[model samples]
Target: MSLRKQLNDILPTLLPNNPAEAIKGTELIRLARINLTGNYSDASLRYHFSIMSCDPTSAIAKVEKGQGYYRRSEPLPALSGAQELLAWTQGRLDDISGDDSSVDSAMLRIRKFRAVVTRYYEVNGRFPFAFRDPFTNTSPLGNLWKYPELVLVDWETGGSPDEEMSLDGGMLSLKQRLGIAPFRLHSARLRLSPSLMTYREDFFQTLSVSMWAQGGELIYAGPIADEALADGLRKLSAAYGVGVTSFGMTPEVLDDLPRPANILNAHPKETEAIMAKLDIHKIAAAQSRPHLDWVALNSLRSESEEADKLVAWLNHCIDERRAEPFKDE
Candidate 1:
């Protein structure tokens, strides 16, 4: 059986009837981990979201706070593919931080570890690994199927012991370096429930500050080139009670600020020069010609719209979790 099939089969059994909330929670962990590496290409991170989906549930979930760190009980079926993803992400992180030695060491260690266990499983029909007392190997597949287990599991099955190491001098560090505060990036998904509606304003406020601090701009929902979308953004801003202020961006400022396009669009070179010339003040001042063309984009972005949708999807997962039935303690 393929790994994806195995994952789908096993994961469902771990939850209480509803599988959607579990899936959402899993993706959240995956996203935060991958993004920490800073290896996502223009659209690499987007692929993670594209592959995500969930079902609705009417059961309400009992909230648990900081329930110890989650650890997968079984090895991922697409272990090889996952390794490649890690490599790609780590490579980008290495490049950004100017640390080749650490990257090389980490990759080599992972390769050696994988090779040792995979060989054992193929030759002996079971993993040759063992864990500390009171712990035993299990499949991450969650007993949803009767397939024979091939991999050993403990705390390590889910990720490396140093999964948090990726944060050192990486994306998370960047945020800390900027002293950027965290806030809720509100989503339409949360608006679906009265319980979550309270977070709406707080969410947007958080996102706005985070984006600005990260050298990102607030690009609300809009069409790539639709005038209607632009007008819609103006209305949405007022309706949502979000604020927009004018600013300046000389070529230097534009070059330094991280544009959402650079992270989402497949082709950014064409817009790089133009985007750098966009001065916020000029656009707000109703400047004509070249300046206006660039200014229009700064006020809104296609990527922001995409990010907002992803946030909404995540919010839905939260709602789904809250609605799930729980067992008595």
Candidate 2:
């Protein structure tokens, strides 16, 4: 049987009294483009499902890969401090330099740097630039350039810092120095209850992996539950089905995470954060207007009224033109 159908059959048995909860959660997962499935716990009788949407090559991956590691398994080269900022700046330098040798050597250097940054904070109990505000280019909360020597090195001459460069002279240099690349790495944290927090992280990661695996672009991430997760997933599923049957999901990954919240919601949230994050506005609209063909037919009446008004205006203009006549020579 189809996964959706199987889910439908199992849902009643899982949550006899709370089928609505299952529906609500499932719907939200679909909308959020997260993938998950779960089994009922005999002890609690509460279907404990996880949200799975984080991508393997997500921002977390970038941080890890930059430091020659994986996920949260190992120490990163930078850990949200001045040293991290330096490393980030240096990464841009390497990108700009286009130094093949440096690129090859960067993984080791990044790992070492991540370790150093962690230790720097261990002794000092503070990060290098906790709030440098990279987007605004202002250190409103923290000064990243605590080390002047590092700053000098960052802003030094615009040449191939370590040669091995080629790509229209200074173009490659400028690109790296300015941190202008096709791929950018970023990370942020959100607040949520322990239960909700776990779900959110799982959902984010699952979505990330699916998107990357399918060569899709990322949008954003956040916690969702109650009616929100339900509504989102339903809309998403309607637009795109679930599991390995879907373009970007694997059965193993899908079965490992949270069940859809839609099955549980009697009335899902009209406004869900996942919809906004994924830019699934169109999908949401379509779901909301399931009878969109009827809407178009109704809208045609308004168009007809407008057309009548235009016809009257055009006739009036023609009459005026006739009255005025051609006075030009």
Best by lDDT: 1
Candidates in order, TM-scores: namely 0.15, 0.16
Candidate 2 per-residue lDDT over residues 164-262, each given as its tens digit = 121233443565477442111111111111121132332332233222121111111111222333344444445533211111111222233222332
Model 1 misplaced stretches (Cα beyond 4 Å)? 1-225, 244-276, 279-329
Error of 1 at 323 (Å): 48
Name the 10 consecutive residues with the lowest summed lDDT in model 1.
Answer: 186-195
- Runs in model 2 deviating more than 4 A are 1-11, 14-170, 176-183, 186-197, 202-227, 230-329
* Alpha-carbon deviation at 297 in model 1, angstroms: 31
**C-alpha-based local distance difference test score of model 2:** 0.25
TM-score of 2: 0.16
Model 1 per-residue lDDT tens digits across residues 42-122: 344333222322111111121222211121222111111112212221122222345766544443433333332233222
lDDT of 2 at 87: 29
